[model samples]
Target: MNGPRHRIFSPITRAGRASGQRGAAVFVVMLVVTLLTGLGIFAVRSASLSTMASGFNRQLTQTHYVADYAVLAMVGELGLNAQVHSTNMTSGGSTQCVGFAELVAADKTPSCAQYGYGELNALAQTYSSQELLQPPTGTYPATVVPGSLGASPLEGDMRIEVTDWHPAWPILPGNDATKGQLGYAMVTVSAIGLVRPNPTGMAAGTWDTASATAAGVESSRAHVVLGPILMSN
Candidate 1:
C-alpha cells in the first residue's frame, strides 16, 4: 500500500486567510479614528458655549451695579429741596413750582401761576436761594470712571430718568379723587446701565455707532420710588 497520503495546504488558501485578517484590522483602525474625531469636536463645542455663558454673566452683574449707582447719584445731586431746571415742562422759562418736592404735584397748566400753591411750599425757604439744579433731560449717556469699581477691565455707561410719582387714589364719596393723595409728594427714579466695548479715546458724553452695535452688549435697569415727603400749607 502507498504511504498514507499527506494533504499539502495550498499557498493561495493561506494567502486568502491573511488578506481577510488584514481587512478586519483596517476596519478597526478606521472606526477608532472616527470616534476620536467625534469626541474632539464635542469637547471644542462645549468649551465654546461655556465661555460665552461666563461672559454674559459678568456683563450682567456689572450693569446692575452701574444702574444702582446711577440712581443713588441722582438722589444726591437733587438733594431733598434743590430746585430743578425741569425741561420736561416749563412756563415763562421757569417751572411753576419753587422746590423739587413742590414740583411733585405741580399742575402742567399753561400759566405758571395757576396753581394757587405748590405741594412743599412750606419747605421752600430751606433751599430757596440755591442755584437751579441743571440736570440732563430725557435719556442721556453717562460716563464710567476708571478704577471706580476696583480692578475691573469692564467699562460701561448709564442713563437715568427722574419724574413725579402720580399715584392714583381710590375714589371716595366725599373726596376729589383726581387730585391724588394730597399733603404728600413722591418721586420716581429710573435708570438703565449698559456694558459695551471700552470707549478709551472717545469724546466725553459721546458714544459711536460702532460701540452701540457691538456684539455681547449687556444692560440692566433699576426703578425706585422715593418719598412720601410730608407737605403742609
Candidate 2:
C-alpha cells in the first residue's frame, strides 16, 4: 500500500463557477427593480391627469352658471320694455345707467321736456331727429334691477359684453316690390363668462379679439331666434 493518495483540487475553476452564479442573481434583481420603477411612474402620471380633468369640469360648470345668470338678467331687462333699445345697470349704483344712444352717439343730449301727453310726441320727434338717439324713456316699463352675478369664489376671471341690439325684420324678396313687410324690434344681447385656470393645470385658451366677436355675434343670433336666455361655459 502506498502512501494515501492526496485528492487533487481545482481552486480556480470552483471560484469561477461561484462568481458566475453571483452575477446571474444580481442581474435578476436589477431587472425586477427597473420594472417596479416604471410601474410607479405610470401610476403617478395617471393620477395627475385624472385630477386635472376633474378640476376642468368643475370650472366649466361654474362658468356656465355665471353665463346663465347673465342671460337671465338681460332677458329680464328686455321684458320690461320690448321696444327699449338698450339699458345698463350695475351693482350698488356704482356704474351709471348706459343706454343705446349713449353707446352709439358721440354726443348725448338730455331731454328738457317733462312727462306729459303732447310733450311725449315732442320728445319722440327730438329723438328721431338725431340718427343715434334712442327711443324715448317710459316706452319700456321699468322693472326690477338685476343684481351682479360676480365671479368671486368660483373664478375671478369672468367678463360680460352687450354686443348688438336691433330690430328683427323679415327678409324681403328682391323681385317682390309690393311685399308686405313684417317687422319686430329685436333686442340682441350677448355676454361671456370665463373660469380661471384650475390649480391642477387645466386651462382653456383665452378668447382672442376675433373669437370674442364671433362668439358674441353667434350668441346674439341664437338668442334672437330662440327667444330664450342662452348660456355656455
Candidate 3:
C-alpha cells in the first residue's frame, strides 16, 4: 500500500545543505579579505620608502649646491689674486710683493712647496688655512685666500683651499704668462652638513655634552662633500 516505500527528504536535511553552502561562502570571503589586506599593507610600505628616498635626495642636492658655491667663490677670489703681503727676506730667500694673479705674468710659476705643490721656493705664494688665521707678521706674509663661510643656519661649514698654482700646461698656442693669462689651478672645496652639533667646535673643553650622530632616516643624515675646482678665464 505505501507504493514501494518512496522516501522524501526532510526540512532538516535541506537546512543542513544550506548551512554548508553558507560556510563555504564565508571562507571564500575571508580569503579574499586577507589577500586585499596584504596588498594594502605592501602598498603603504612602498609609498613610505619612496617618500623617504625623495627626502634624502633633496637633502643631498642641497648640500651639493652649497659645496658648488664654495668652489665658485674661491674662483672669484683667485680672479682677484694680487700681492697682499711682502714675504720678507725669510727662510725661503725671497723679497717680493706680487699677488698670485701677478705671478701669472712672471716667466716661471711660483713656489708652493709647503702646500704639497712643488719644491722650489718663491717670493710670493698663496696662504694656507692656518696662515689665514693670523696676520702677516714674519717673512711668510699672509697672501689673500678664500676663508671659511660665516655663520649660516642651512649649512654647517664651508671651506675652500687653493692647493697649488702653475703655468697653463702644454703651453697652449700663444699662451702668455706675461699677459696675466695662464692655465688653471686646483682648489679643494668641502661642505659639511651637520646632523649633530660638534662638541669640539661648539665647546672645546667639554667631552660628553651631546651624543654623536646615529643612523636613522637618510633624509636626516649628515653629509661631508669635497669638490675640486679648476679655475681659469
lDDT of 2 by residue, 1-233 (tens): 78988976699988999999999999999999999999999999999999978866665565566555445544544554433323221111112223334633655332210111123234335646531112222211253232222222222232233334433344323422332332333434454544442222222344445333322111111244212222111
- Backbone clash pairs for candidate 1 read none
Steric collisions counted per model: 0, 0, 2
TM-score, one value per model? 0.53, 0.47, 0.43
lDDT (Cα, tens digit) per residue for candidate 3, span 101-216: 46746654443212111110111234432321112122222433322322211213233333233333444455454434323333222222222233234421233433333211
lDDT of 1 by residue, 1-233 (tens): 77889888799999999999999999999999999999999999999999988877766676677666656655554455323312222224324433343553655433121111121222233447422111122222445333543233334455555544433233335645455434223345555556555435443236567766652333333333323333222
Candidate 3's displacement at residue 86, Å, is 12
Q: Tell me, by lDDT, which candidate is best.
A: 1
Question: Which is better, 2 or 3, measured by lDDT?
Answer: 2
What's the ranking of the predictions by lDDT, best on top? Answer: 1, 2, 3
| Candidate 1 least-lDDT 10 residues | 111-120
Q: Model 1 compared with the native: what TM-score?
A: 0.53
- TM-score top scorer: 1
- Clashing residue pairs, candidate 3? 82-99, 83-99
Cα lDDT, model 3, residue 149: 22
Model 1: how far is 133 from its true place, Å?
A: 22
